[model samples]
Target chain A: MLVEIYLIAVVVALACSLPGVFLVLRGSTMLSDAITHTVLLGIVLAFFVVNDLNSPFLIVGATLVGVLTVWLIETLQHTKLLSNDSAIGIVFPLFFSIAIILITRYAGNVHLDADSVLMGELAFAPFRRMTLFGMDFGPKVLWSMLIILIINVLFITFFYKELKITTFDPGLAAALGFSPVFLHYALMTLVSLTAVGAYDSVGSILVVGFMVGPALTGYLLTHRLKRMILITLITAVFNSLVGVKAAFVLDTSIAGMIAVVTGITCLLAFLFSPSKGSIQAIRNRWKQRKNLKKQAASSHIKS
Target chain B: MEQLLALFSDYTFQIVALGTGFLGLLSGVVGTYATLRKESLLGDALSHAALPGIALAFLLIGKKDLVYLLGGALISGLIATALIQWISKKSTVKFDNALSVVLSSFFGLGLVLLTHIQGLENANQAGLEKFIYGQASSMLLSDVQLLLAVGAGILVLVLLLWKELKVFAFDPVFTQTLGFQTRILQFILSAMIILTVIFGLESVGVILMSALLIGPAVAARQWSDRLGVVLILAGLFGMVSGVAGTFISSIGRQIPTGPTIVLVLSLIVMISLIFSPKRGLIIRWVNQRRKKKAYIKQIEEKQERSEKYAR
Candidate 1:
């Protein structure tokens, strides 16, 4: 059971983390945050309309709301009424508050539990398995996550050149005839598609951590984009495993533990990366000072 | 309304206003440094970090004094900042990396402890939990006075050291070249932020205090280019929001004061961004329209003069 659950955790972690690399690089990290929280408002509204969590219409409506999250944030940014971060800060909190307000006001009418919707149990996920085509398959969540992961991989692979170009240098990409805006919208859509369930799996807090942590750790470990993606995926999987294993042993929340483990790994990378490691850089400075002092003393003797 | 007043009137409104005001004044003074350092986000992180401290304070003291709870919160907020700073300095992680590390970890740990604290099932626990969203309506006059002393002292200290802070924030390279201790200046500033946020956590709660710390400073920035003016305006804006938000929340029974204060702060930021004289959108539009007209006139005059030459 734990093994099945851990697999689901990995699938969700990868789905979040793969796009996270691009999200962080594009400085849309906060976008993941905005999408994650604002989607709750969507889920609540969808639930209010259909009153069912398992309905496919729920996801369809949620994705539309996710797009609105980006749209609202962009619109807010355009108004010059708030700075970029401030606009996001204002809009998401308002949306999130409204969702909470709705829940508090209509707790009985709503089937969407706010706390569970915010965070979910990966262990219990395995128990919700579905049989597809008469073969032994995992949970519907696992299948959905795998499908999203495939989309992310396909997008990353097929448009790898375009993505790298646009992300690294959008102006140049535009001048060279690629539509930055198109790429931007498409990427945002992908983020929304992946984030809804990704957020559902480990919760908003962990989804962000996964989205941010693996990619960030990879960034510190390497300068190249390809290596960064591969490393990010590996580290994300590792985090999910450790998190799931720890939760199993300690009887703690898998999502919370995963967030903690990923944070710890990022800290380790920060401390020990060869080129930019803080301690190594500081030590190098001290060594240079010691050599300079010796040279000064020796020159004084000669004089 | 008269009957309602007769039934509901008490010391709580005045006390809550005084508490929010004290918080407004203190954070406004200290947050200038937070903004200047480009570490405004730290306020958000630190406020969240105070949860563990609040829990620890409750456990260690086995008492429920506001001062003790806040003091413990202050220690934890400082710890969060210190760990973030030290980890960043000692490792390759960037500032955000250090920050996110402390933020979620501390917040998660706090949640875990809260699970235990929830089990306490006492009167203190009921009121104490209000710190999650803030229950400013419950503030005692004594708590407000304590906040006043702390806020006033910090305000005086900031006033005294205004020149030094100005020098440091505006041109750190220049200040360093001038033989000033940059690290010490940074330390002093961050210390003030930690202290301000500690007391602030009680009134505004943990999550929303960052809105208080950054919102006024951000709003004030759009109105002026001068550092001193920005600082003073920010402080005033903060005070205005604190007071107005408290009054509005008082009208409603269930609305939390902290979010109300932040909502008000956001409105002020909106106004400043759109309408301030120099940085605001209106000024830019007016300037651009004027420039475009002058350019069009220049082209017309050149075309007319060239036609006469051809004739």
Candidate 2:
């Protein structure tokens, strides 16, 4: 059972980390953070209308709202009235607050568990079963996670050139006949989609870890975007597996434990990665200082 | 109208009003630095880190004294911040990760202690938990007085170090070369940030306190380029949000103050994001349109001039 859980976790982590790589590179980290918060409104609103948290319409509604959040923030950012980060900071929290308000006003009248929006249930994920065409399949969590992974893979592959060009040099990309704006929105939509769907299993705090941690750890390992994406996928999968099993053994909060473990992995990568690791960066500086000191000493001795 | 007037006359609303007002002021002033540094998450992290310090202070001192507990919280938050710094320095961990580790550990420790206290069924624990979400309605006049004093002290410190802080923020290397004690100044500023978090944690609860610190500054940044004005404006935004949230919660029986304040503060930030003069999105769109029009006009005139010359 534990082995199955770990396998599922690996798949889940890899899928979420795919879009995270691009989101981090485009400097839309905060948008992803904002989307994670705003999804509560989407989920609860969908629940209010559909009366079922388990319905697939919840994912659709959340994704659509998440896309709207990205669009609104982009529109706001273009105005130059506020910086991009501040615009995101403003939009998502207000949406989240409204969601919280709706919950308080309408609690117990509906089954929209507001607390579940904060800390998702990763351990109990294996229990939620899915049904296909006349056969009782495995968990719904696994199926939804698989569906997101497929979408992420397809999108990343199809728009690989557009995304790469847009991320690196929007001006050059525009000159070369690609609309950076289109690609930017596309990327954000995918991020929000994946994040909103993924959070149902991983929770808000751990979603960020999956988003940034793997990409960051991969960044330490390589500079090339392709390699970074691949490595980030691996790192995220490993992190999720480690975090879930550790939580099971430790008997603590799964989401919080995953976040802490992600932090630890990032720390490890920051320290020991061959090039530009924190310790390596510091060592080079020290070596440069020592060389300078030696040159000064040699000149003095000669004199 | 008479009953509303009586509410104003009562002591509870007065105390609640004053305490939140002081918190609003401190949050606005300190939040400017957080937004500028782009470490807004630090606001959230530090608040959680202060939780255990409050519980520990109560445990050791056997008193629920706000000042004493706040001091303990301040010290512990600083230590957590320091530990995050040290770990980032000495090890390979990234800044965000270090923050994550410290925040969770401290919060988890606090949770354990709190649940233990709850199990003990101690009478003192009775309203102590209220600090987490902040029940400003339950505050006394003494609490209000302490808040005002702390708020005043923080404001003075911000004024005293305004020049140094600005230089450090914009260009630290230049400031260092110009003979400023960058480390001490930074340490002091960072300490002030933790203090701000600790102070707001009492009324906003540790989890919700970051909204107070980060929200107004974000809104203020949209409206102005001058750091000083931005700081002041952020403070004003905080004051408005604080008062508004408190008022709504007081009038509405079931609404919690912290979430209401955060929601209200968040609304101001959104308004600034889209509508604030030069930085606003609508104005930028207009500017781009105008610039494109001017460029087209210039091109047309130049072509006409060339045609005349040819003739």
Candidate 3:
């Protein structure tokens, strides 16, 4: 059970971290945060329509709403009324608060509660079985997340060049016949799908954590995009394993523990990354100072 | 109408309404500078950061006293802001990334501590969870008193330092050239923001507190460009939303006051965005359409004159 949980967590982390690299590089971490929260409304609305949480319609609805959120924010941005941050700050809370109110008033009797939405229960994931034609999958969440992970991997692999071009130089990419706008929405759809898949196990907050934390850490450690991706994957898997173990010992929320670990990992990289770490910079400065002092003393002695 | 009047007249409703109104007003005033500074999300970060402070205070003091909890929150919020400032300053990381790091880590710690508190066999721990989404209905008179005092203090401070703060907020280099202690003023302004966030936590919760901070300011910005007018309008908008949300939530058994207030604030923003005089979307659209029509008309007139001359 523990191994299954750990694998599921790693897959979820990988799924979030993949798009997260683009998001962080594009400086859209806050947009991911917005999508994570607003996607709740999508999930709840989908539940109302399908009358089941397991329906794939949930992912479709969430992706639509996620795209809508981006569109609304972009529209607001075009108006030149509010800054991008304010627009994000405004839209997500409106959608999220409405979702919360709906859940409390209308869905109180249902299993869709705010607590699980905020602090998802990973421990309970193992007990929920997915049966497909008399075959038992260990956990339903695991299979769903695996599917999402595969989709994310395939999407990234197929469109690697396009995504890279669009992400780094949208104007150039457009000039080269790739539609940056289309690619942007495609990436957002994948982000929303990944968020919804991870929602049941790690919740929204950890989804943001997984998205930004490893990506930022990877960013600090490397300059190359490919190397950053590799570093992010390693960081994500390592953080998940450590987080699960810490949660087991502390008997706390595994999702929260994972987020906390990811944060710590990022901080460590921020402080100690060989290329860009503050501590490294400081040490180099100290060394430079010492060398200057020695040169001054030696020159004085010669005089 | 009578029932509505009676609801307003009720003591508990009056307290909740007054407290939230003051909270809204305070956050509005402070949030203006925050929003203009592009630190609109700072309130979100600080509020989430305050969670661990509240939890730590309870654990250390072995009680859930409001004052002590708020004190702890204030301390932690300041630390979080300071860390954000430091990380952004000392490292190559941008401000947004630093904000994200502090926000998530602190919030994650808060969650872990909250779960730990829950595991402990203490009935008082039940009330602690309310801070997450806020239980405005559970507010007592004493809490209202604390809010009033803090709110008034912040208002007075802002009033006294209005010139310095304005200069600093608009242009720190100019303020420094004027020999103003910009760093001190910046610290004080951050302190005020942190205080407003802590005071609001009991009502707005950690999750939606930033909306209360940013919503009214954004709404007010649509109407006016002047700082004074924007601040005043933001305060008025916030007060209206706060009072109205309180009344509406009081009317229903299931409606949550915090989210209701946020919804009301968002509604105000939407209305202001659409209908405000200067920068409203509708007005802008109208102006564009008129300009296009006039341009086309001028072209047609020129064409007619050219044809007539040729004939």
The numbered model that scores best in TM-score is: 3
| Residue B294 lDDT (model 3) | 100
What TM-score do all the candidates reach, one by one?
A: 0.85, 0.82, 0.95
Q: Write the per-residue lDDT of candidate 2 for residues B1-93, one digit (tens) a residue.
A: 887788777777777876787788788888888777666667777877787788788888777888888887888788888877876566544
Local distance difference test scores for all models: 0.75, 0.75, 0.88
- How well is each residue in B193-216 modelled by candidate 1, as lDDT tens digits? 877877776777665677788778
TM-score of candidate 1 on Cα atoms, chains taken together: 0.85
> Model 1: clashing residue pairs?
A270-B92
At residue A164, candidate 1 shows an lDDT of 92
Cα lDDT tens digits, model 3, A1-303, are 989989888888888899988888887787888898888999889989999977899888987898899999899888889987898888888888898998889898889987787668788888889988999978988888888889988999999999999989999999999999999999999998899888888877668888888999998999999999999999999999999899899998788888899989998998889989989989999999999999999999999
How well is each residue in A128-148 modelled by candidate 2, as lDDT tens digits?
778779787887878888888
Instruction: Calculate each model's fnat, 2 decimals.
Output: 0.09, 0.14, 0.56
Task: Put down candidate 3 lDDT per residue, B68-183, tens digits, no spaces.
Answer: 99999999999999988988888767777777767877888888888888899988777887888888888899999989987898899989999998888889899999999988
How accurate locally is residue A290 in candidate 3, as Cα lDDT from 0 to 100? 100
Name model 2 segments beyond 4 Å from true. Answer: A1-4, A131-136, A293-303, B36-41, B48-146, B169-171, B205-208, B218-230, B266-311
In model 2, the fraction of reference contacts reproduced equals 0.14
